[model samples]
Target chain A: MQIDWFTFGAQIVNFLILIGLLKRFLYGPILDAMDRRQASIRDRIAEAESKQEEAEQEAEKYRSLQSAFEAHRAERMQAVEEDAEARRHELLARAREDVEYLEAQWREAIERDRADFLHTVSERAVTETIQLTRRVLDDLADVDLEDQLVTVFLGHLQNPEDALAKKLIDAFEDADAEVTIRSAYELSDDQRERLLEVLEKRAGHSLTLSTVTDRELGLGVEVQVANRTVGWTIDQYIEQLLDEMLRQLEADLDQRLTADVSATGSMASVRHR
Target chain B: MEISPDQIVYWEWRFVTVNATLVYSWVVIVLLGAGAWFITRNLTVGPDISRWQNGLEVLVGQILTQIETTGLRHPKRYLPFIGTLFIFIVTCNILAVVPGYVAPTASVTTPIALAMCVFVAVPVYGIMNRGLKAYFKRYIRPTPLMLPFTIIGEISRTVALGIRLFGNMMSGNLIVAILLSLAPLLFPVAMQAFGLLIGVIQAYVFAVLALVYIASGARAHQNNGEPAPGDAEPSSAV
Candidate 1:
């Protein structure tokens, strides 16, 4: 084997040229591309991390806002429930007051009706009793009721008690004191003279007297001296009887009302059960 | 048969001549340069890349990795020299499988030329990495009296580098030719196949030895005036 100097030198030069060419075409471009790719990947990773951090922050912000909104909702709901409860109580109280007022008005109307009925019945009974008594005296005793009333009044004057005598004397001592006599019917002159004589004898003085026919007296006479009066009248007896009757009627109505109230209370308790 | 491509001259003009070795070397160079230019012309810096670009990248990357593993701190600084040595030799050896194609590496003149390039590059890279004074200081390391022996060691290893590649490639070709004449079929084909494997291995061996010489020279100052690991025995059995 032999080596040629010219071939050796030419091959060396060729290898050197190949080295330069390969470097320019291969190593330089490939390495640069790889380095650039690596840098780009690194930048992308950093950007992704930053975006993740921002996303987490945003999520946290939204979470807090949601919690605040939930708390506010609960508070508002509580306030609304309280307002509703208060309104319900107010409405119930107003309804109860209205019921009580209406019940009172109804009871008052019933009481007024009962009182009017009792008054009408009492007036009719008194008029009937007085008429019946007048008819009985005229039919049985053959004496007029007015004459009897006058007789009774004269007796009360003639036989006056010690206190009555003193009152009459004191009344007669007033010189300007005039006597007014009211009767159911017009008195005969003889009856008036007799009443005057009796009164004057009891009083031990002379008296000025005025007679007035008042039909409301109902066969009774009244002698009034100033503001004082002395009389015996059927109207007074009838009034006493009507008052007793009214007391009895009121007692009955009160008892009935109490029973009705008790019954209503028992029914209300049953419904509650 | 002629042992070297230098004997097959196509033209001559006194000392200047055109021979098979020069022609085939140019052919390998053109093929490598054109292929590199074509594949890397439209190279992308993105994750997506062409298959050809991928293959080229793998090749250049492996060469860089090999240089780095040879104790060179900056592998890229030695990539062009060491990478070209491997590619050119491997391509020439691989093309020997083609009919009537004599490998340029089978020529004593081509291997001697490549060895001389490595010889020159070792000092150049060493001086560039560690100053000239520090680079030359490695010859007299351990003692100044070892200078002549270190010089002889350097020269002999360069000679060994060239002769090792030339002997292996030439013997494989010679054996294949002799086997073709004797058995003429199966043995020649098998030996040719075996020669292909040997060719690739010789390429690797040559490149690695070259990287070792360059690395030892560059790091001589860093090893505290002692020679680097491969400085004592830079030759490869392959």
Candidate 2:
């Protein structure tokens, strides 16, 4: 057996070249690509994580905003309810005032109508009584009541105790114009002279006297001085009696209305007097 | 039939001779170089790999793992030398099944040349790792009296490595050739199959032994102050 030095040397060189070629092409490139792929995977994972974090934050922000909106809505609802309540009370008060005013106006209108009716009745009754008195005196006495009224009026002028007559006399004394006496019948010359003497004596002054026949005076006499007239008539007594009766009726109506209002506790129950 | 390729001389000169061993060894080397260049030319660094590339990667990866399992770190550093040894021996032995092909490993010349490479590499690595003085100092460790025995052991193991491979390959070829003349049919075929198996085994054995030797020498300094087993145990009877 023999060894070939040159052949062994050549084999060693061939193996070394093979090693160089394998290292460069095979090991180096494969390892580098694997590293790059791994790096890319890691980057993708990191980016996904970041996106998830941002999404979570956005969700949290939306949640907080929703909570705030809900709270604001609740506050507005409460305010609206309070406003509605206040408006309801204001409307109620205004309605009550309107009711009370309308009730007062109604009561005043009722009282005015009652007063007008009572005045009409009382005036009619007084007129009828006066007419009856005048008729009865005319029918019972065959004497003229006009002459009698004239005589009585002359007699009152002579007496100092007659208040109406005294007032007339004073007026006559103060008169700058002529004094006139009007009656329902013509007076005789003797009666006229008598009336003139008594008036002058009571007055203690000289005065011009005039006489008039006024049938509208009925059984009354009127004496005038300086556009002033004083008269005594049955109509006056009828008016006084009517006034007293009206006062009594008004007091009775007021007491009944008070009692009815207290009993029913309703102002609507009041009726016309 | 020749038992050793070195006996078949093609030409002769004053101090240079051309023989079957030289020719076959060159042939294996050329095949290895051309194959490596072709396979690695379009090597991809991505997942979409060719079948041939896949095979090479698996082969290289297994070789690296085997060297690492021998307690050797940096398997890549020793891969070129050890891997080349495996490929050359395996190709030379298995190609013997061809009618005209004489396996280079069946010759004492080829085995001795490979063993001498290992022998030279062991000290070179030891000296590189532990420095020149420390590498030589390992022979007389624990006593000065062991120097002669250590030298003799080294020389004897180198000679044994060359003889071991040459003997196994030559004997298998010789037995099969003789059996071919005697029992021409079944036994020779069976023997050739067995020989193929033996050839692959020897390839593994030689590669592993080269790795062990280099690992021991290179890592001797870092063995926690313990001595390295510079002489590895025989992996096969041959």
Candidate 3:
């Protein structure tokens, strides 16, 4: 081997220039592409994570809305039940008031009916008494015979408990003559003693006694003296009978009236438009 | 006594001496030593001075400027190796004109020594920058099938570097010496001038080739692969 400086120098310059060209053209493209790929992958991963978070937020919002809806529904149902319960209580209270009003009206009607019945019975009794007195006056119109009869009637009327005694007592009072009284029916021992005591005080035996069981007057004794007589019986009085019948009728009518009113009111309310 | 150009002078131990060539090699040594000293002394960053600094600045500036133009990060990394090559070669080529001075670079041994140093340095730097495994693997890269051929080519290139330098320098020295002895006056001057021109050309060529070798080795390790098909070219001259 021999040294060749000329050739070596020329070769070195040529190789240097060759290397400069190769570095510029080659390697640059490959490295640039690799760096770009790395950056894009990092960005893609970040985007994916953010999207996942957004999805989760949407799911949470939907869940919250569902829960709120359920709670609201439950609250509405509770309010409806409470309203129904209050209405039921109000209806029951109205029914109880209606019943009480009917009972009170029934009692008032019974009192009114009793008062009417009593008044009618008392008027009938007064009319019958006046008619009997008129007939006695007509029969006494003949003079001597009438006087004798009147004396007898007057004697009878002196003891007013008997019908005959009450007529004799009326005749004697009309003629202004004294009268003797007698009883057809036998008197009890206590009754005889009461009659004698009365006659002795009056200076005459002038009492008439009778047992009368009339349609109007039931059982017991009657006494007559002059134009006065005493009448007593065990039967119910007209006023008392009237009062009992009126009470029963009034109760029935009042009950019916009250029931009708209540029924009509209930039907009208149900039929309202 | 008659002597022929093909004759050899021998000593003990197989040492052969070429008398004129030995003197030329000495001339090469002195010129290199002096140039190195002159360039090193009074080195300054400032401008506006003697032609020596300006001349050096041009040469160094050209090398570094080319390195900058290549767009390498550290041009100074190759400065010592490349700069030494340029200076040593320029000194070796110009030393032929000095009386009783020999150009050592004209011998096979001197140029072989320089070439071997370059071969070792390329691999060492490759391994230092990369590693032994990486530097060695550069030969087999791109395709493993081409490993044997690439290895043979690299070895041949290194051997040729030594042979080429030795042959050119020796031939030129011989021709100049022969011409000066036969026609010592104006004819010799023409031949010497021819020698000087060729000498400068050889030095530039050697230094540029050195840069190529260094760039290839360093770049191979940097690439971690063989040169691509488009990047491949014939190795430079010896």
Please tell me which predicted candidate would have the highest lDDT against the true structure: 1
Give the candidates in order of DockQ, highest first: 1, 2, 3
Which of 1 and 3 is the better model by TM-score? 1
Per-model i-RMS = 0.9, 3.9, 15.2
* Residue lDDT tens for model 2, A107-178: 766666676687668667766876687677545432266567767777777678888777886686657747
TM-score of chain B of 2: 0.93
What RMSD does model 3 have? 20.1
Q: What TM-score fits each model?
A: 0.70, 0.58, 0.40
In order, what lDDT does every prediction score? 0.83, 0.73, 0.55
Query: Pairing residues by index, what is the TM-score of model 2?
Result: 0.58
CAPRI-style class, candidate 1: medium
Worst 10 residues of 1 chain B by lDDT: B228-237
Report the lDDT tens digits of candidate 1 across residue range A1-273. Answer: 777999999999999999999999988998787778779999999999999999999999999999999999999999999999999988987776666656656765676677668666866776687668766543443127677778877876676575545566566665354788888788878888998888878666677878998765555788888877777766576668767776776676667666655655555445434
Error of 2 at A268 (Å): 17
- lDDT tens digits, residues A1-273, model 3? 332343334334433432333222211222233335457667888998898899899999999999999999999999999999999988877776666556545644664465456545654554454444434433433334423443343344356486654443344453322323333233445545554454333433443433332332222234444565533322223445555655665576567667765665565455431
User: Tens digits of per-residue lDDT for model 2 on B112-167?
Assistant: 77887888888887787779987777777667798898778777877877778888
**Ranking according to TM-score, highest score first:** 1, 2, 3
Best by DockQ: 1
RMSD of each: 7.3, 8.4, 20.1
lDDT of 3 by residue, B9-110 (tens): 222233334443333443444444455455545444332345765565566657666555433456666655666565566676776787644565675655
lDDT of 1 at B79: 88
